[model samples]
Target chain A: MNPKDTSTGTLSYEQAGVNYDLIDPLKVAAQRAAAATGANLAAHGFTEVPASRGESAYVVDVGPFYLASIVECLGTKTLVADDMQKLTGKSYYDSIAQDTIAMAVNDLITVGATPLVVQAYWSAGGSDWFGDAQRSQALVAGWKRACDTCGVAWGGGETPALAGIVEAGRIDLAASCTGLVNPKERLSVGDKLAAGDAIVLLASSGIHANGLSLARKLVERLPQGYLTKLPDGTTYGEALLAPTVLYSPVTEALYKAGITPHYCANITGHGWRKLLRHPATLTYRIDKVPPVTPVLRFMQEHAKQDDREAYSTLNMGAGFALFVRAQDAQRTVEVAQAAGVAALVAGRVEAGPKQLLIEPLGIRFGDDDLQLR
Target chain B: MNPKDTSTGTLSYEQAGVNYDLIDPLKVAAQRAAAATGANLAAHGFTEVPASRGESAYVVDVGPFYLASIVECLGTKTLVADDMQKLTGKSYYDSIAQDTIAMAVNDLITVGATPLVVQAYWSAGGSDWFGDAQRSQALVAGWKRACDTCGVAWGGGETPALAGIVEAGRIDLAASCTGLVNPKERLSVGDKLAAGDAIVLLASSGIHANGLSLARKLVERLPQGYLTKLPDGTTYGEALLAPTVLYSPVTEALYKAGITPHYCANITGHGWRKLLRHPATLTYRIDKVPPVTPVLRFMQEHAKQDDREAYSTLNMGAGFALFVRAQDAQRTVEVAQAAGVAALVAGRVEAGPKQLLIEPLGIRFGDDDLQLR
Candidate 1:
């Protein structure tokens, strides 16, 4: 028996090598330390928006506007792309590049800031990685395409060849986005979040850059590895490599429709539990949920996880959540649809406790599940 | 007998695994692709500063002020810190943290922008690395201290535990800084670069986070590795771990003293070749150079590199350079001195073909050596 095996003998994120117990404290310490440096922004005629400290993105209050910034990385998904490329002599960097950009731009829009510029950080084990013209050019092309899709400049970036620290024949990818919230009114830090708000969840495409470490772990148990096909007839690697859905257009449409979400959460890392990411003492009640993508269903069944484990550890179906007044739910969905994205009015926010309740799956996660601050 | 060895049978940067010939074309391709996305910024009421495309930082015209941003990483330096920590049983993360911040913020200041917020990207191979409270806490303390030193907010960052791609028991460090250049006139993208400017050189503590891969390679040939004592009575590891000088103070002092440099170069990756960073057809003649630090001297002697190779591949001594009008050069030096940094009027710019001339060492580097765009 595996020493780290749980009582259920099933996979867990910690078993997959990501232990929140050891990682969250450092995050907390960083936030506490970061909190003390807010005063330093004053020298540049800007002030830290105190409410944005633990939010998805960092926001600063400039005189006529606000700027939100985030630095995010596509964790381990590139490894999957690399493995798949070896199986079928094709370059997957274009799709992975879109995934990396979506990972950052999606988080930036949570604070109602439209992304303005994105700087890339590509650390390769050696300079030889760029020798493949197809892969490298695809990455360049896909980066530009993603920036065009998000309407942000593909700003200059750093391409460092770190040999010893990064493993040979591998590349680590990340992006930093700086956004603009003009007129200052678009800044949303959850101060306006309240009860009786409708929760509209935007659909996710496949796994969508989160839970990849677990998914990649699950592949080892499969007979054919990444070639295993889901029930929908698509190979597992192809499904997981589907470029993430860009949500900027939907957020921009909601703004154009004069419907500002009281709070927005990019459902990443913590799966559906991210619905309660606003840090308010309110309960998120989900009555209806989107259909799980085939790739995610395959992961759920193969991992032998129950509803609680599946919903808490994977996106399940939703990739983003928007909390707005109950009356605007249908219009929010309409705007998302018009913007070429699928969204649904799935839940409501209620006063009482800080927890997430998925009624259809009979799953609930308490506040202790996430400790970003 | 080594097939890849140079004629002199001494180590070179390419032999150490960092090959610019293989890397520069990808950068050129990326710039070509990124240049296409510059128009995207116009939708958000901002425009890309066209001249800043290939500069140290990406600058955007935000109506009243300009925002310059850069994402830089401390390449392979952390591996040295990790190695030293094992030998000394002490945490060098505090110093490495400052080095990471300086790498990004120093690049930001090169555009005449005052850093307002810095966001970190810390990617560890596994979550267990954070279990070391001393090292992790030291990183937090040092990050906050660096922010305090630069007078910039330590904005929130992403701490992703990348298991498969990054090597186990190791971490990758990078930071992104967004700065503000107020009054528009302070924005320096080398538009005013002329033939009659004087070059001011600033002293570096040691190797300020550049050419670390080569330095780490040299340690492998040493009998005692990082524990080897230098002539200065300090271990090789200790000298390399010394915190890089935060140059924001010198830039701020220059701004206060009404000394707007025609161009500024943060001497990093290309070593002294970075002194000719600005894309101008002018010759930079250096009559005097800064005193080489002891650690650098040791690396030079052991690596068996001559003056030309050493200066081109390492900082040697000067970490930053300012090209100001001849009349303002002395005042700039005095301002830097008042800010507690040593500076010297080391060179002059002349109307000639693009190149760098080290008069004292009889070294000359033509324009073909550096190709950023």
Candidate 2:
């Protein structure tokens, strides 16, 4: 019934009000336009690392080392917490803080840069949004806990009370980070992505900070709102607001074990399709798809979304991906396990057109869908 | 005659809905909590610069070099642009972009760090907001122009369409930058702010990304809306939207001339009260207060504000303040002028309690007004 008319003839992300077709092109144009200003760095005695313009973070060559920085927002996930807070007397901002930091440090670590500092930007629609003492204390505790989890300092942040720019009762949360990729050789920008490379996927802690807008849209149709019980006996809102898995530990473990990833992708925004984010003429064929968590399945069934649409829009199971040499695949999974994260060799690269083929679902996404270039 | 009466019986910034009493303590508490997590950075071989926790930027001591990073928002200035767009068919996002970048890079340069790269976070309430191609193009062009003006690379940015969390049809613009302070001696954290240190005031174009909530409230009482002409013959909105002066050039000039400043303050949200943001117990005495710009005077007069509240809330005239030794004050102004920015010897630091004294206006702001610590 959706306008996109997928193979299932049911629903699509485009119909869910997220028109990636319009947004991706704008991002591409913005990147191209912004790249022209790279020459300005020369005046400050720093040069932008070549080909780092379109990555999750921008890396700049600062003489002896490279600094990677990124500014990311937590999206509408906090709205879910706010909704649940009204239904249940508990505050979920503690978990939301972890989700916020996870979104930033995950992208920061994807380039092998160890995050040094993380800054918070909490914009409340009204000053009264912080009147709840429990919520405020929980947010502070959780932000500090998340920073401790990732081995990054909790850098100071700006809390602006933006009365009219943001929604009256809700808060808009965002953060930016600076990480260091020293020795320069550790910088990963997908130059090593090639045929025969093995793709290893790290497990996600349920829906990790992506597709919340579409998920929130689906929540509106729920018969019981935030009180809806899921198959696992927990409330749906509680399950969806679970703290995200921090990936910097896995990355640090990999570095400790001397396993250098050729390419790394933070499984956010674009879902599992982020595995093929590298710019290379190779087919990424997934032989084994990870099991979907209960929260994801509940939202998928209720939203009337099929495998193709859901997998392409949310992190079905995979939270992060690493493409490394074929021999390093098993060891990479071992390092992830040592760091308390579950991971496995899920796919391989083949000499062919740029595509992502899912064997279990019989879904194939072409390069046209990934217009990051 | 009006609400929230002080002894002077005049309008106050607190009446305009921004209560620093609540917001300042929360910030102080958040900083205190975030500092406990700084020990996490030590594991990554990076240490937090002592006492840098509460500064404008969080500085990291990375062995041979020090890095300063900051995340600042453009405040409610964009709301003015949105309102102006409806009143007139023209978009003012271009100037808004400069204001956003100025908010970021200005903070970066305050620590004597040369801004190396700037990353933008432009989150719109809906995807359809970009349907207006002219407005989107203007924003991108303006962003790049501002980055160019600051002599920093326009590193990649995240343009997330955050529906429901942000106000519909509006965008929340903020940016983060990482700057390097090489030689380490270039770092300035008020340690060099002696009692006899002279203050060099840099002229502001108008209100630069602060006090827009009060300014907008004033606009409502206007007889002619955006077309309301001020004494300078320019409309109130037009003058307020003037591009912010990029202070990176001045900082760069100072760096080139080897005239390290004792302290620097970006006169933003807290206005001239920010001049005494340093922790030292010294009075910042302004014997030669700068002339009030036309746009600011209009906001004060029409809003029925006294000189004390006006100078304490808006920039009035001074955009930035640099405290240096009395001998280097003239050369600092000369260097600022060489960079094409207007500067003047506005004040001096005196041995007294922590306060800001506008002697010319017969007003004094105690340490209670500036409470980031």
Candidate 3:
């Protein structure tokens, strides 16, 4: 496998003056506050699947089926599209649509559910933002492609023309997805995750829809702006705009293959440190760190972010991770590879504290770094 | 019942710089382009329920069950929160949160699907905006109340600090909800909607969540800004921010009471004209239009809008409408009243060209006004 295809990822780096430390606590408080109302579901013949509340998506226990729903945003990634369209007269809306859907479906697959319907919420600062038919068509086309890749249907969505709330000329993109886990046996919420599980890493295409606020901030320091060239001669913006890898294929492949992973994690905002997302107290020891690609390397260099920050913030190649029994580890890798995603047995779950250790990089993230609970 | 609670309203009047003529075409193009992709739903063992698209929500046919999903936005409404915080020492985040969730869940109920999970997407132009703990807690509390009122779990959400993409110091709030329609019997898509069906109009509490852009534009003309008093002597912003009625309870009551409506509409954006949202060829006729109340009266009088514009642009008095068989008309009103929401049989359906006629007001909306299809 290509070393650049080996993957690890996180979302904590500060960029554009947005502080994760400040914003995260508000989310934590909101989650805790919402817990009281979770009981309201019981009145309507539904039950809360305990502990699924804080995960990337919330899982609901219906009588005959389990439903998983997630609401996610592409952040400021589409601002890159807005800028690039002005700079190159090229509409990247299609890929921007794909990026938004990828952000939703990718996180959903981690829970072992197959997405059934995907909805789009595209709010432009001005109504004229959609005046460009090329941009509109590209966006709709790209969104459809992403849904097709994920094997889900494009449900419906809202396109609000918010005049004063959004910034002029720029559009904010977000989406929500609903997936079903039938027979209840396919549900994986880390309860089955145990020490000694094999950790398989899946490769990211490149900075899949997180840390754009940081990346946008870093671009201002570049002499060429988005036109700066990387080692491969591709423009900085083009490289950054690479469509996010659809992790759904790998998850679907494994589910069909009957290889049950104890847990899965999408290495987005938190980078490689996300490998330790399991609730069980175990150490994620990484024996091999994926080689950093030029797009990520350029961003790290321009931003003066070190190995720890880059690997923990930019995917550094690893996009998603799966934890499975030792017996199923190789087959899981085979399934991902068969589905055209890079896969490797990068580490093992060890009986220890909840920490993520990158031995080759000589860096570690303590349990305190991940406080989603 | 109080005159203010006599019920039935719509938001159709034209408002500040937002032209549905220009915006609706883009939506039509996008929806048309997206229709090609909806066929992909069959890949996941699910099929798109025919003609469910272009309505308030999308309904998917899952063998033994039908799932309805909706993505709705609280357009520029949160800006009201941002302004109110500056005017008053108090934060209205709780009610803002309730309003956001109500927008999504209310639309879902129109299709007879009980909300199972609701996920929120809050995008701030900057991260520091959430630094206000009071604002965050208020938002969390209000969201919980809305969920509790509607009887659904606060599933999960994505809070993105999108610097430069949204207006600084403001947040763009939207949400998507997934609902379940089981036994396949409770579904109300207007298929059974016969001409002569009684039109039950449900009363809106106040401004609800629509037409804020126009209201905000009119507010600039006020010397007192948010503190400007209406005839009732309440501040303009406070009255406008009245909690939107959580319509889920009414839909749930009608479902449990064995009262099935042929169609339902959440009176927002397009106002009462949304009553014609059903694909069937039918006209909705209004005999007793609900009386306009204080908050709406204040805005219309101040904006110099006429009855046609007021009823069309804002909910005036009617908030939601239900199309039921003539025999079930009174029973539907009883069901809504029992659920704590004021409702009345305000009108009836007839065999004619698609249109909405308010005889008491001598105003009619032709089919050309609404172009969702």
Candidate 4:
């Protein structure tokens, strides 16, 4: 029996506070809208003009062995954070700055690159001219300070005073970052992956901004203290808002150490199953899933969510995962630990068609039929 | 006489069918919520990361003369496009793409860099198991085509299936770009502007996607053909959706011609008045504004807007303006013409506290109240 399936009530998109049904019509309309823009072409042809679609960032070769990537974040998180009143205690600017960094650097590392520069765009809600200025400066300064500490260059940004859409006190923050990747070190999903490789997990700080819809629903159902102060005295907000760990140092260390993992993936919104986009049948034998952090435990208990649902919806604890040679697993953990991350030899890979099986739990998830697929 | 100032009946954000006031409160709530996230940083030696209040994009240096800029368009346009049932026309995508390009390249050029690559993020309303594949492919292809035609590399992109906030038919498109600049050729507002530099104007295609809040209202009050179609028999959608003119060629021409303009500014959302960001008092004498394109004439007639309001909000005909030496005025126009852009001498510089004077009309606008400083 699934220990955590609490309520048998039907849970749908509307129940989760989102109307999923409207999406198809919206998409169809969007395609038609996109087609009408055929006349808007640039001189070099429309071939290289970045169409307004896809991932928040993309990579390009600027020179030999040097690549540039751009990354951005959706403003929806800002809306959620605002509704929760997370700014007064934590400095909303700081959370967004970290989010900006997380959004950018995560992608950089995913593509085997190191972040080098950061820029941000902040759209303030108010019409109080000076208030906007102060907030804009404060936000930029915080981002600059963070980037400076990370040894990344702080490129200038745009502060748009969008009075009509943004409210007096609200501000929407998005960031784009450029990073460099050595052409030879870039990794794609199709890169060869053989069975018997070890799968390593780097513990995550918690939610890290993706899957907020479900997380929000779970939080809404819980008693107040469940998110703010657990029985253990830890505030739920702090645990959930932990800035995504920057894996630059670790990835850079691995690169320098001449340890090239067969695959490295950021375990974000959709969790472990989404990472298996490669053409290999592999089963992961997990004798140890990281101990449930306090926040995760609270969410599971209060929301009555099943283990599979929790794992599928949240990062749980692992923010990044690595597929490496079984022989090199020990060294990989050592290297990651040296970089200050608590790395765990989470699982082992076995021969199979491209599949993800969680042992001990006996839960199997695959790319085919996945929620997002 | 302001013939286009048709009484749209005190139209406001809410009355325009968008609840800007309600959205404003939501914005404040969201900002406050985001602020609460900064207190969780325990290991990075940082207590709080400031909120990105107004900055929209961030740039970080990955290598010499190479920088990455990341940005996103708030889903405002997406919602509007979806409501209009013109999805495949891609007005939203194309507009956002142009705006993204404009925002990035304009900034890059401000710092004397050339944009070389662009990456985009597209979130379809949902994961249409079968339809998503084809739609995503087409979207990517369109984005790639745009980037390629602009002489920039179409790197990689992400198409996330976000089924919640975005309805089935609506998609949000955002992008980031990488640009290259010679350390020596960088330009800023402080670069130098004498009293005699002539201002050259390059034509704008249409509204080019900014100030839509007002434009849409005006369109609604007018007849069906008022905004999207003109007396010339061209569809207004096609005209309004005209792709932004890439200024790269013009910039390159000016550079190669050895005629460094006092300033080369893209006439976008804020128009002429916002261009006077420098400290010096400079007066602009406008003997000729580019011929009012059919779209502008239609907007003027239908909306019954004043010249100042129209010029300040829309690009009119000129998309880019250059402040060049009086002697090089003719050459600047010739070069722009050679690059397939119709350029003409629109105005000239004069001694005064840095001010933009639309002569003949005798209207002067400045950044006195708008300046962030």
Candidate 3 residue-wise lDDT, B1-373, digit = tens? 1223212232223436566665676677667766777777777777887667766778988777788988889987787877888889889888888889889988898877999788878888777878889998888788877888888888878888877888888889998898888668888876788888999889888888998877777676778988998878889999988888888888888888888878888899877667767777778889997777588888887777678777777888888888888998999888889899888889889999988899899988888867668
Off by over 4 Å in 3: A1-12, B1-15
**In candidate 4, what are the lDDT values of residues A1-373, reduced to their tens digit?**
1213424432322344444444344344444443333233333222222321222234443444445476555434554454445434334545556766776677666656566655555555433422433334445555655565455655444444444444455554556666555644554333545778888888776667665555555554556732468667866655665566777677767777877777777777567665574445666666667766677667666666677776766677788887888888889989989988888998887876556777756777775734332
lDDT tens digits, residues A1-373, model 3? 1222211222225524567777888888778866776788888778888768666778888778788899889888888888888899999888889899988998887777888788889998887878778898888888888888887877778888887789888899998898887657888888888888899988888877887866776675677999888899999899889988988888888988998788889888777767767677889988976667678877777767678887777788888889999899999989999999988998888999889899998989988776666
Model 1 bad stretches (over 4 Å): A1-8, B1-8
The alpha-carbon deviation from the true structure for residue B336 of candidate 1, after best TM-score superposition, in angstroms, is 0.8
lDDT of each: 0.88, 0.84, 0.81, 0.56
Best by TM-score: 1
Candidates' DockQ values? 0.84, 0.74, 0.69, 0.16
Could you tell me which 10 consecutive residues in candidate 4 chain B have the lowest summed lDDT? B48-57
Report lDDT (Cα) of residue B59, candidate 1.
94
Best by lDDT: 1
Q: Give lDDT for model 2.
A: 0.84
lDDT of candidate 3? 0.81
Residue B51 of model 2 has an lDDT of 65
List per-candidate RMSD values in Å. 1.9, 2.5, 5.5, 7.6
Best-to-worst order by TM-score is: 1, 2, 3, 4
- Fnat per model, in the order given? 0.88, 0.73, 0.83, 0.10
